[model samples]
Target: MIEIRNLKKSFDDNEVLRGVDITIHDGETVAIIGESGCGKSVLLKHIIGLLQPDSGTVKVDGILIADAKEDVLYALRRRIGFLFQSAALFDSMTVYENIVLGLWEAGERDEVKLRQIATEKLGLVGLGARSLLDFKPSSLSGGMKKRVGLARALAMQPQYMFYDEPTTGLDPVTSDQIDYLILSLTESFSTTSLIITHDLFTVKRIAKRVIYLNKGLIFFDGTPKELEQSTDKTVVQFIERFVK
Candidate 1:
């Protein structure tokens, strides 16, 4: 579980997040939604220790993420996974190499174990055998790259997963596929996930709960049905815009 309390952050003279509070339970899928520049990504970064909050605390399980030492943060990071908006895969690395990079970098050289984990992760994302594993990121489609990124994140068998704009530039079909993959992965791994996205459909399909942020504040926090039935003008407008 993760708890964010009175989280605040500022850049120069502008505040990005203001007194935001959120809690994610173990094995739950929570989606963070809001208009652009509402600090959704910043919030995710803070939770993962990629950014520091000027004021407030991000607690993972029982430990305060903001107060943790560098070594402690590093160790904590290994138990979490992050999938960037851009897929964030190295063009130079093959699919297999990308999937297993973290384990190898952590000096996990048990060839048998490495192969076992890599194969299982790739299979989970619908990737074929080790034959295509040697292919570079450039050789794959956008959706395939996204799947590869997911495979890489799963390689660590993280207890918590964070996704930043997972469906961002993809077509509707592709987005739906990715959402299905997310749902499948969540059930298979029983991992808690924090998905930062503005896609309403994605939120409805994958989020067990949704947190709506506006101007750094949590404007609404509830289930999809609650959000859709919300009378709040902001929530209404937000949902209306995404309605096909």
Candidate 2:
């Protein structure tokens, strides 16, 4: 389980997350939705140790993350996989190489085992052995790169997956396909997911629970059914705009 207590952060003067408190249980797909600059991404970064909160605590599976020791932080990171907004694959490496890079960087130099696992990860994302393993990230289409990114994230068999705006730049059909892939993979692997998105369709399709943030506060936290029936004007508007 992941828990945030009284989390707060600011950039010099502008506060982003204001005394935020939330808890996400295992095997749950929780979507965090808010307007731009609402600090949704900031929350995800805190969970991953990319950003530290000015005050409060972030605990993952009983480990304190906000201010963990370096070794502890590294250990925590190994258990989580992050898919960035841009896919973040290396331009010079082949798709297979990209997937294996994390393992290599972690000091796993057993080529035979790495290759086997990388191949399995590729297949998990609906890619075949014949998929261009030698082609660099620059050679792949947008959707293909996204798939490769997903495969890389899965290579570690992370207990948690963090997706930042998974559907931002895609067409409707492609976005839905990505959403389905995320939903299917999370269910099949039983991995906890924290998705930060403004996409309501993606939220309705994949989120088991939803958190609506406004002006740096959690306006609502509940199941999708509850979200759809919320009565607050802001919450109601968000639901109508996205969940409908």
Candidate 3:
């Protein structure tokens, strides 16, 4: 479970998050939506302990992120997987190495075991062939890179999966594929999934709940149907003026 209470953050003179409150239960798939500079990123950072909130608290599965010790925080992070917007794979690493990088860092030395783990995760993301594991990120297409990134995240066997703009750069078909993968993975793993995206289609397709942030606060919190059918002018305008 993820919980936030009165989460407030500010940068210099700007208040990015103002008294935000949210609770995500275990095994839930949720989407957070907002325009640029709406504090969506700040909120996500707080949840994962990337930034300390000026006030309030962020707790992941009962561990208070703001006050956890270094070792505790490190362990907490091990249970959470973040799929960054750019895939963020190291340029110097091969697909196989990238997938097992976390495991190696955590002191896993068995090469055969690492290979087995990588193979299973890659298959989960629809990249079943073992030969592709030898290829570098540079040789893979955009969608393939995203799938590889997803595979790497899954290698941790995380209880929570967070995706940042999972389909921003893909073509329509590829975007749909990513969306389906996300939905399928959520059900297959029963991982608590939280997605930060601007794509309405993604929200409609996968999210069990939608939270809309506006001007440093949550403007709406409900199901995707309620968000789409909202009569509020702010929600309507955001949807109409999306892609900013």
Candidate 4:
């Protein structure tokens, strides 16, 4: 389980998060939604130990990551997968090479085993074509790059997956496909998913629970249905902007 309590952060007097508290149970898919600059990405960084809270506690399975030792944090991070907004792929590397990079970083050295793992993960994301394996990120389309990034994340077989704007630049059709893939993979792997997105369609299709962060605080927390039906002006206004 992930537990966050009284989380707070500031950068040179700009307070981004204020007394935020949230809990995500195991095997649950939760979506975080807010306008840009509401500190959604900052909160995600804190959860993965990329950023330390000024004053608060973040615990993953009872291990306090806020101030854990390097080795401890490293070990804990291996169980988490992150898909950056831009896919963050190495343009110089082939698709297969990129997929196996995670396994190699985790200390796997057997080339044959690495290839097998990459193949399996690529298949999971529907990018298993032999011809595509040799292609580089520079040669793939935006949606294809996203799929490759997801395949690479899955290469680690992480228990937790974090997606930052998973469908930000894709067309509606591709966005829905990515949403379906996320839903299918989470159920198949029984992994906990934390998604940060502005797309209400993706939220409705992928999120079991929705969290609205406004001005650094959780303005609303409930199911997607509740969010749509909410009478709270802030929630209703936010939804109306994208839902119509």
* Candidate 2 to truth, TM: 0.94
What ranking emerges by lDDT with the best candidate at the front? 4, 3, 1, 2
Judging by TM-score against the true structure, name the best candidate.
4
Query: Predicted candidate 4: what Cα RMSD to the true structure?
Result: 1.2
In model 3, residue pairs whose N, Cα or C atoms come closer than 3 Å (at least 3 residues apart or on different chains), thus clashing, are none
Each model's lDDT: 0.90, 0.88, 0.92, 0.92
Over the stretch 116-197, how does candidate 2's per-residue lDDT look in tens digits?
A: 8888888877776556677899988787788889889999889999998988888888898899999999889899999999
Off by over 4 Å in 1: none
Worst 10 residues of 1 by lDDT: 125-134
Q: Which stretches in model 3 have alpha-carbon errors above 4 Å?
A: 241-244
Residue 163 error, candidate 3, Å = 0.5
Off by over 4 Å in 2: none
Q: Which scores greater on TM-score, model 3 or model 4?
A: 4
lDDT of 4: 0.92
Off by over 4 Å in 4: none
Question: 1-244 in candidate 3: lDDT tens per residue?
Answer: 9999999999999999999999999999999999978888788889989999999999998999999999999888888888888999887999999999989999999999999999998999889965788898999999999999999999999999999989989999999999999999999899999999989999989999999999888899999989878889999987775423
